[model samples]
Target: MTKEMDVTEKIIELLHELEHCTDSEQKQKIEEMNEIVDGMDEEEFESFFTLKLFNKTDKMIEEEKISMESVFLLLKSVGQHKVLMHSQSYAFHSSSLNKRFEQMIIEEEKKKEERNEKLLIDLCECTVLLSNEISSELLSIIVTCLLKVALKKDENEETQKEVEIALLALSYIEICKSVKQEWYLNEIKEIIKYHQEHHNLTHLAYQSAWQFLMNRFHFNKSLDEVIENELHFSRDATKELEALIKCVDWKRGKGEEKRKKKNKEELFLFRWLQTLGIFFFHWRLRNEECVGLISSVVQVFRASKDDNREISDKCIFCMGCAAENRVVENEDLLKIGAVDLILEEMQGPTLDNYFLERHMKCLFEDFRRLKNAEDYKNEEVKRKATKRKVFDKMEEEGFEDCIIGLCHYICLGEFRYFSLFENYPEYFVYL
Candidate 1:
């Protein structure tokens, strides 16, 4: 026989023996086979290992010839590329793999065994790779399993890894357009609270929580409302926000090296800021809390404007929303210097289109309110002065004429020129 045929026959023989072997013997034989496969070069590995092992996974599972543990090891060895390539055709083609994963989760719960927990964690990692293939029902099952692992009271390194992986999986599933039932909402909240309390898991928890909230917001607005309302008044949320604000190293030291070191924390802080902004829009904050939130957001907006566009954009949106909602009144906004900071951005050279549009909307609304007062530009000169400060800044920055020209165009019924300002009706009356 040819050497290739001989090798194939020997592999087949080993598989046959693996089926009849004891657990110990099967493990030894599987390890030896895995070693042999692992030693092959990339091309050879694809032909012999990937095609032979994973492609036949269903048949092996049906015949009870290979354990899930073995399959997981093989998947890890082959890496993500091959797995994702075959995922749709092999791993996700049938319901069997999902059922097996569910069964593993059930077994772990009943036994509370570390080995089973580890296995489930490994499977959870695999799910992250196969997220695009996960169905709604399967996604729910995986989420429940991961949450159970994450909520464990154990505080060991292994337990933390489990929590990290679980949160990672939830984050992935959250972005997959997964369906979340109402019953799962409370558990998700608890997960968020628990991870928020754990120092090491805070980022992961918040990321997962944000994803969950956003997914729910997309699917069912009321469910998101429930979670947001519950979280808005929670001590945990308040503490987390405070902690996030404190973590910011405000000193923009000399050199790119220092700035790079701070970028990670800054990114996390921005994400937290974005989440808070969304929550603020939904839940009414007390005056003090609202002011504090605005102050932090404005600080970020100022710091990020020149260096980070993403954060700068998010901060501006948050500020504009706060202004529009009157979360803090015009007087309060000026007290905290929010209006001044916003005017500075509006007059800056690098103005974002979205930011300018929203800022103008805020200015239009404030101006219209001032103009519509009973004392119309007479005794209300102070309010007019306060309002004109924004336009005054614009004029100083050479943007006043542009604003006036746009206003005149809109007044003359040239609607196409101001389509971007369509959302703000106040602009028509005031500007």
Candidate 2:
């Protein structure tokens, strides 16, 4: 046989021997297994570990040759073999192995044994290593179990650890784009509602909700039903606005000294904003609510301008969407100084070219509409003044200046490529 075939045969032999060996003898055999694994090249190593080891475990579970607890222990023991753990071979079987382990956890949860719960928690923690391999169906199962553990009432230190690990796992699983199971959505809603009511889990709960929304938006699923039906964004506008503002305010700390720790909170907050912008772009709101939302988002954009360009860009896009909603008029935007805020933000070095183009297009359209409205008003004034022998052109002059100013901003530098100016030379010359 070739060297590779020989190695494979040897590994299979060792695996069978280790399975039959007593617990004490198994330790020495595991050490020998590790030694054998360490000697193989990358491809052979992955093949032996994933295909051989994983398949053996599957057989052991199916045959009742080993308890789930014992199998978990065996996996843990082999995981200590650094070569196996880090190899692409391990990654090859990680999803299947994780799916099996998660299934075991779900089964164990029905028993509600503290030991089993602890094992489940440990297994959940270990799954992070293989998170990228987790499939959508497996992710749904994992999230369902983790949410149960997170919501468990046990307040002991160990239980608290379990809850923390479960939350972490939920966070990782929450971002899976392919997870479209409605059962998962229902559980996530429960977690959000429970945490929103209970002060202790509020932050973790919101984090989970944020991730779920992001995943939903990524898959192009509609969130309007969820927001309107479950979240009650319209019924509880003030409370929801406050919560959103709190999320927006979670900024990364300034300075190199304070930057050692990750800004995960801020990162999650931006993700929440992005999810909202994508899925709820045209959500209707009252005038007062619109003002609050617009103001808070603008502040977030300004704060993120220098530190996080992506967040700033997303904020601008979301705000532009909000502006388009019929509930938020240009007059309301002007009253709140939104136009000035947008203008200032646009001038910043961090503004992206695409978003800047979008911003200018919006402004050009709004100004052009306003100019037309003023022309109609001026025509009425002219007709009345001609009959009454009076004249007035002041408002028309001011309107023309406003249109010219907007055109100037639009035509500046690279923005001159805007199709509006190209399509209508009359508007440009009137400037």
C-alpha RMSD of each candidate structure in angstroms: 9.9, 11.9
Q: Deviation in angstroms for 111 in model 1?
A: 13
Which whole-number lDDT from 0 to 100 does residue 156 have in model 2? 65
lDDT of each: 0.57, 0.53
lDDT of each residue in 187-242, candidate 1, tens digit only: 77776666556555646455655555655555465764455455542344445555
By summed lDDT, the worst window of 10 consecutive residues in model 1 runs over 80-89
lDDT at 128, model 2:
43
Compared to the true structure, candidate 1 yields what TM-score?
0.59
Off by over 4 Å in 2: 1-130, 153-168, 171-182, 217-225, 233-265, 282-290, 324-327, 349-355, 361-431
TM-score for each model = 0.59, 0.53
Best by the lDDT measure: 1
Local distance difference test, candidate 2: 0.53
